[model samples]
Target: MSDSLFLGIDSGATTSKIAAVRDDGSVFPSELLQRPTGSEGGPEGVIRAWMRAIDEYMAEHGIKWSQIAGVGLAVPGPRRSYGVLDSGPNLPDSFNGWNVEQDLISALKQASGRMLPLALGNDGNMGGVAEAHHAIGDQRAGVVMLAPGSGLGGAYIDPTGMCLDGDHLAGMEVGHMAAPLHLLDVPALTCGCGRTWGCFEMYTALAGLPDLLNLALPRYPDHVLADPSLGKKERVLKLRGLAQDGDALALELFDLQAKAMGLLVGQLAMAVDPACFVIGGGLIDPDATTEAFRSRYLGGIESAALAYLWPTQRETLRIVPASLGEQSQAIGAAHVARLTVKAGSSVQPFSSTSR
Candidate 1:
């Protein structure tokens, strides 16, 4: 342990990742811990699980409350205010309008007999923060990150390593941005966000794969993924295996996904003109597949994006995979906590009347 450490917790729909980061923003892989989020039990259960993980981690590592400078939590939904969520759609209904920061701090005080400063951040934004500081390391360059999973989430990290949340703290909802439906030759389909027309998320998210497959399956009835016996979950797994085996249909689906990604990146370039784009989330997980598929997918994205980018922009913009993988959000949260404590704002003792 260093003289002072920051604790970061990334609370996802299924898992909560906890990690300790040093002042220099270095996190040991061995110190990373993942626990079930206990979301079925709602907000309290989730908070309790995090507390237990923190308690277990500290006990195992011989860390004391005095050694922890602050804590940061990365959550999935939009923030209503600092330390609170407007709604946690991916989580249980109970998390809606929850003050996770205050509750977690209260739990820490009860369990550890001390109050620590804690900060809250959107998970997607936190991922970008981690990449901006730890992965890219160029303070002069802006970075935009797109995380394609069940839904598409995005974040913009400015040159100074701040995640831009805009005036209402609801900026960077890139997934809901209107997509070029013509590029995909798909009808204007409603997005999960309830948009009547196509959105970027409808074309690239895992949730949209089934719709894509349904549209394409008629042309390739014999496709392994078209088996009537296969359920949605199994079909995704089978598709990955097929992709690894170089199945044409699987490759085509991924290519279409890449094309949508490229268009989204190009559109973002015109708006943010980020120095680079970092692609992360479950969609890009290597999962034992050979690099060939990943390369092809990424290559397709770059090629398509270049067609849409300005000539001057084409030379400077780069697209890369997230280096930190699953740990990115946790590390970013820890970094945010460290920054919060250092700035001497949003650091406070637990007060029952604070809300």
Candidate 2:
């Protein structure tokens, strides 16, 4: 393996992505390729799919296993630490109560024919690393990232562009944090974490949007989503479409949710006081017609976040969209691989035997 090349892999429930990153944080032209995650295929199926994709990516780019200095894998988490993924809301149930770390390491060794140093970490934490080190430039600053997808996730990066949660391995599970009690009802939205009501995700996260709408349906009898026949996907899509079209109900939801988000961000700011906040995920990546609505949503948060801040604190805080687009996780995984190999052992070891 070329010493300059590092391999990074991100395995999500629906897709598996791989990338080759250089030591200086730049990725190869053939940076990313995606493959099916094979969630229903069982463990063997998932492992084989990852192996095939990795092998193909390496061969297509003439990258040898020998040239690779390290390998990093980012997966969904909430285990004791990296490599110990007992279960995640995003992954298949088959992965729960299994030895994900060792199994993946052994499988990777068998597939690649090498015992390269490996680092495994939470995808959200790695995404923070990518955002800190690669995205938004090389400057060292305190950056907080909020990815609103299936659920909300957060990662904090210190001024040196290093992950703030590295000491713990798994990044902060911000979505599970409680929301304002006043905004919650007894039968509030059901969150992915299995909690009903009060979770910050109830008002955010694409997956949680439908549940939020379900609660709001009763208040707007004439709203399209009020129809009992609409499924979750239909409810969410209709809401999104209406919001994009400047529908009053949808716009009001954004305006109202902004206050809740402002409270959360304000609370976080009171604790960490980060330099900037970067927001991302499919929720923010609207197409041409929806750009205006996207701006409104972001604007709402920006304005609301200031509610709790004084003039001085609000003056310096900045929030923006992800500059790296969808490649943040892949690139961050490679960077973690490079850093792990350099350190000889990761602070969050992928295998229990590592220390």
Candidate 3:
């Protein structure tokens, strides 16, 4: 380990990612640890899993906490009230009252034997930062990140190429916005967060898309729609098979997903008018066949007379897939650690015991 290694952690629903970067901008896969977020066990279980992973990685790398610069974490939900995660309905009950930022800092202090400068922010904002620094290249300012995974997560990158982490770290909740559900009688889209009939998440999130597809095709008999046991990988593969076999239902479903995604991106473009939009997630198939996802997402941006929208005279929106693949959040967290370390002149001691 370098003398001043900065660590970044991207914690997602499935796996937790960690990366370390040296001062020279050279990055190494410090450790990639996979653990159940234990959302079922609640927030404390999630925190335990994370800490255990870090400890295991440290031991494996023969790295000590004192040699490390700082740690940055990319959390899933909006930071409510002093960096507490109150609205993460997916998180276990234990997380309801936990102050994530403060708790993590204390934990790291005990583990590292030094006060670690901690910076906690929304995962969406970190995704934006990753896009700006790694994907946008020369086009730094005015970038928006559309992380299309379980749902649509949004992040805005400013002129200096830094994502505004936002007050309480609630930068964007694009998935929670109202989306169209022409097929449903209720017309309201339901979200995983328990809100009904809104945003593309109702139809696009990994858990929600299959049900939406089934609902979209009410004409088909109820027994024909399979068990709906399809995961993201399986769903994408199914779409490819359907598209290959000329299945009209698959085509329609994919198109609907694209349009819903596009409209949401359009709304984001209207708000920020970014120079480029970076899209990322499991829905994006590697093969060129899924280019429609990119095109439809970009084509949805069709509004005029707004100064904030990019290209005042002409529509100049560039929608590109994310460059970092699945590691974007982890890398972004590493940058966060670097910044935190740079901001603080001295390292503080970590309290050995939990509060």
Candidate 4:
């Protein structure tokens, strides 16, 4: 392990996750915590949860404030700058008004009794970079990570394997890009950002699953999933279980998700042309109830892309599952803290002295 350690915070709509990570992206699973976030109480709810998680993890791992170098935060929206969040649709009302850097700096120092340099970045950007760094490393000339939950998020890596956070509005807004008009045969589902129908995010995430289910239900009237008591969550669980067994309704819904997702993936292949695309979030996990189901699900995504790949070859951009699983974002944020601080002494240099 390196002499320095860093803290990474991933503040999501429903949960806030935290961990202590090394510069090399290594993390001890024992030194992690997850808690509900700033939904009801606003920013204070978020800060309290974040601090409590940090305190509990540091205590359990015997890590001290002096050994920590800096803190990195991953907020789930576009950053106005390094430390400011421009929009937070999923977050509580206070998040929209609070100054992330100033508020976090004051609260974090109060928690640890020392001032640590804070670094901030978009959640999608960090998640993509983390997956690229771990999944492809130096082997790939380029990679892009697409997260398809809550809302779509994307990150790109150059040939040298370093993730790129492009200047405001140019890159990373891939989610906001319009989906093909043909895909919107169902009722229009507007995004929280107030975008109209046909947005890439509307058909790809769990949020979009309800809309997909409504469309699929009409066609699968004879299927067992049509039971009204099943609800969205239960219906999803049952369908995935059945899909693993080649059930028609289950397979068709997944196929629909892939077909919609492939539109965006296909578009990315033309513009960014990454060697591989890592897909993450709750929708797809290669590890499943059965090996056959996992293969079928992944295969569904690949085969569906053929329709949209157009000028580019169908196999151009490979798709893969997230290697680091849920920990990828937090680990990425810590790496950002580690890298940024190492780049400049004036940066929030973590204490290197051994306890």
What does candidate 2's lDDT look like per residue over 1-355, in tens digits? 3347888888888998988788676777774598898878877788788888888998898877667777778777766545565766677777776666677778767765867677677788778878766545666678788877767888887775556555566446778788875743324566767887568876766656665665667778987777778787866766667877778777766666655666677778877788778877764775433677768777888887887876777998887777666667777788877876666674346565563
C-alpha RMSD of each candidate structure in angstroms: 2.9, 3.2, 5.4, 5.2
Local lDDT at 316 for model 3 = 65
Task: Report the number of the highest-TM-score candidate.
Answer: 1
Q: Which model scores highest in lDDT? A: 1
Order of the predicted models by lDDT, top scorer first: 1, 2, 4, 3
TM-score of 2: 0.86
**At residue 354, what lDDT does model 4 achieve?**
12
- Write the residue-wise lDDT of candidate 3 on 1-355 in tens digits: 4467777778876678777666544565554556666556566666777888787777888777776777768877744554576655555556665777767777787787877776666777876777777765545468877776656777887865567765544557777778656532324555667887565676555556656665655665442244466554565456645654556667566566656666666667767767777767665546544566445434443321233344552456666677776567777777766755555534332111221
Across 1-355, the per-residue lDDT of candidate 1 in tens digits comes to 4578888888888988887778766674455678999988878898889988887778878778888888888887666676677765566667777878778888977865777787777888987888777657745788999988888989998876778866676789989888898877887667877997788887888877877877878989888777799898788767766887888887778888889999999999999898889988655667745678778878888988999899988987889977777778988888878876766665553222353
Task: For each of the candidates, give the backbone clash count.
Answer: 0, 4, 14, 1
Off by over 4 Å in 1: 29-31, 40-42, 78-80, 86-90, 110-115, 344-355
Question: Which residue pairs come into collision in candidate 1?
Answer: none
**Residues 129-169, candidate 4, lDDT per residue (tens digit)?**
67887776647568878887666778886765445766553
CA lDDT of every candidate: 0.80, 0.72, 0.64, 0.71
Better of 1 and 4 by TM-score: 1
Off by more than 4 A, model 3:
1-3, 12-15, 24-26, 36-48, 59-62, 180-198, 203-215, 218-241, 287-316, 340-355
